[model samples]
Target: MGYESYQQLGVDVADGVATLTLRSGQKFNAVTWQMHHELGLIFDDLTRDPDVRVIVLTGAGDAFCAGADLNWLRNQLQDPPTPREAREAGRAIVLGILDCPKPVIARVNGDAIGLGASLALLSDIVIAVDTCKFADPHVRIGLVAGDGGALIWPLLIGYARAKEYLLTGNAVPAADAVRMGLVNHAVPAGELDATVQRYARQLADGATMAIQFTKTSTNIPLRQAVESVLEASLAYESMTLRSQDAQEGVASFLERRKPNFVGR
Candidate 1:
């Protein structure tokens, strides 16, 4: 299948805004390797697509992306990548969103957990429903919040707050998120699309190159931070993947019970 044959995503472009919807609602828009790779490539194509001036990422149904599919995670046991390989793949996904030339707005219609939280928070602007929640639960799954959480969280909320949330893997409500500087706006569920469209069109209609270049300029710090912190954090996360505790964590999750973690 071609790159256009993205199985896990749905795209609709109208009036210069491309709404990219995660279509796997049955799994709360969970990410698989394919979905993650598709996300990495979509940004590169959308950056060049003349019809698209802005991109808004959202999820179908009641929740935004919950996280990586547990089944997908379990399947990794069959053909696991090296720490470096996994980290590089992860880097691509995060950088694709950060480096996309078109303004990307996260329309967080509902729950944004784990990597979903990162995606929403990483966008140029995040517009979330009032009841939507954000959290990075990779740690709760016996992994570090290394993927994008460690990278983007501290940059938005302070290092102290980032550690508090990432370590505990607690859900932050939409209003609290906005108050803590984690998201740009929170509105009623009915107002989400309109609010996202209003801001997206404003960005699309503004001085195009100016807006794009401004995004480029402002992301310099973020780029530097990625180089400085992301790999090291991912390295630690990868180390934890090899632990017995990690296996138990997944098993407990699948068993629908509290994890009995004995630090190994």
Candidate 2:
């Protein structure tokens, strides 16, 4: 598809690899609700394309993503998200990435916060730049880590470490992330693209069925775990959207100040 065809993402295919670039530019590539919808559609389209052997996902410009867009959050605050929308969007994102038949590689070029971190963790292999940082700050916003964070982080780095990072919302450096087994590799910023491409090419040249089947087999536990907690966490996240703390969280973020959450 041409660049004009996408509003929030850019898609390009070459050498049996399909690259999905988050197109929000340097404003940290924050995802709007529309972008989430488009992402689901992108994956759906990719699933049907036979020539595509590997998928590489990265953000356009500097940062990978900064989580939800501030403008989108403001709108969502004014009109609280319905449970139906929450459940559907959440399921679409997690399932779309997890169930992809092709091997997905996350090329974390820079900081990946919130949903961005979750996306990286969900990928079959994650290669992050040395300068990259990962964090999930859902608790800081008085919300649960509904979208993949709660489900994937523990599987990657163990429950104790995952809980510490999630609760504290502290950033994890790329080297430390690799050491903790949160990422497959951490290379210099300049080598990030080449490294991901190299890996992608290797996968593309390998036995397609073997790679696909192995990926499917490995993801069974994750798929089951996500299914078990998805509904409850999504519902809880939506309920929090209606709370005073959620409103405060958005307002504080917009105002560039600490939130005075009343915990209603």
Candidate 3:
């Protein structure tokens, strides 16, 4: 599988490890439509590549991912995708990660926000820097935590904890994230790379079939969870994207002001 076709993601494979970097550092590696579309496709390609035994997902510059490109999202208000299109797009990315047989490690070098947090939480192993924070501020922007948040968060922490953070749009510090079981390890900034590489190398050089099959076995329940809830969440998200409060949320965020959300 040739990854040269992708525009927003940088793909490099060497010594049984494939590193996929979100390349839009200028925007804090936010998820542009192109990035989102490519992400939904790249995992499948990596899954089939013969030399790729493990995958490391990270960002180019500072933040792991700041979530959706708000400007692009704002534009989508006038030209929103149909509910079916939205559902399928969201499903592709979610299932792509869940169904991939390879072990995926999230090297969260910086803050993981919104969809960014979802990406890290979905990985097989998540390692972050102690200075970084994890947040899924979907509701802050008047959006449903539909992408993978509603499915994964409660399973990682608990229903009460998930709701407290998701509803309030609060940021979870790295130390708390580790304590809450949101991530595997939170090391100092200098240790982030080494920790991720060590884990990736171990998984890469170990018995590949056992690691892959174990991941597959564990993901069975996740796939079942996806089937039960992901679509409804996505559909609700699609509807919310067209809501009056969402418009205010985006506008306020871009303008750097408080949003006066009028429930609609």
Candidate 4:
């Protein structure tokens, strides 16, 4: 199948490794509405691409994705998605990653925050640069971490650890994330690309169907969690997106001041 021109994201294929790069780095590859929707669609195409034996996702610039675009967030604050739209969009992004038959690897180049953090963690394997940071700060923006953050973080770092970070919106350095079992490898910045290439080639050269089948089997629990939790979480998140607190968050972000969230 011919590839669609993924406007904000970039896709390149060589030696059976398809590198999907988030290219809007000037905006930290933040999730604009189009980029968010495209993200949901790309995985389905990648899953079927015979030329792509291994998939590596990373940002083009120093930062990975920075979550939702601030402009988009401001618009969302004023005109939030309808419950149905929110549920469907959020579910598509989450399920797109979970349902992909291929083993996707996240080459975490730098900061992976909010939904970006979810995207990174959804991968079959994750390799982070030692200086990269990981965080899900939705709550800080008066949004719920319902973008698969609730589904995966607890599964990776346990409920207590996940809550400690989720509730506080703290950033975890790459080394700390590795110690906490959140990422597979944390190598120096100089080694990031080579390490990802080596692993991608190794996987590309190995048992293809076996690895794919293994991914499917391992994702059963993930699929189940999505089935049970995603819709509700996204629904709640949509509701909150219209809340007074969410509006305040947008205002505070624009004003570059702390939000006075009164739990409205």
Candidate 3, superposed: residue stretches over 4 Å from native: none
Q: How accurate locally is residue 101 in candidate 4, as Cα lDDT from 0 to 100?
A: 82
TM-score of 3: 0.98
Whole-model Cα lDDT per candidate? 0.86, 0.87, 0.92, 0.88
Model 1, 155-260: lDDT tens digits are 9999999999999999999999999999999999888878988898898889989999999999999988888788888788777777767778878999999998
Write the residue-wise lDDT of candidate 4 on 52-159 in tens digits.
988899997788989999888888878888998888888888888888887799999989999999999999899999988999998887888888888899999999
| Prediction 1 TM-score vs. true | 0.96
Q: Model 2 over residues 54-143: C-alpha lDDT tens digits?
A: 999999988898888878877887898789988888888888888888999999988999889988899999999998899999877777
lDDT of 3 by residue, 1-264 (tens): 688899989999999999999986457899999998998999999999999999999999877899999988999777888998998899999999999999999999889998889889999999999999999998987889999899999999999999999899899999999999989999998888899999999999999999999999999999999987788889999999999989999999999999999987
TM-score of each model, in listed order: 0.96, 0.96, 0.98, 0.97
Best-performing candidate as measured by TM-score: 3
- Candidate 2 lDDT (Cα, whole model)? 0.87
For model 1, the local distance difference test gives 0.86
- For model 2, state the Cα shift of residue 71 in Å: 1.7
Candidate number achieving the greatest lDDT relative to the actual structure: 3
* Model 3 alpha-carbon miss at residue 57, Å: 0.3
Cα RMSDs of all predictions? Answer: 1.7, 1.4, 0.8, 1.1
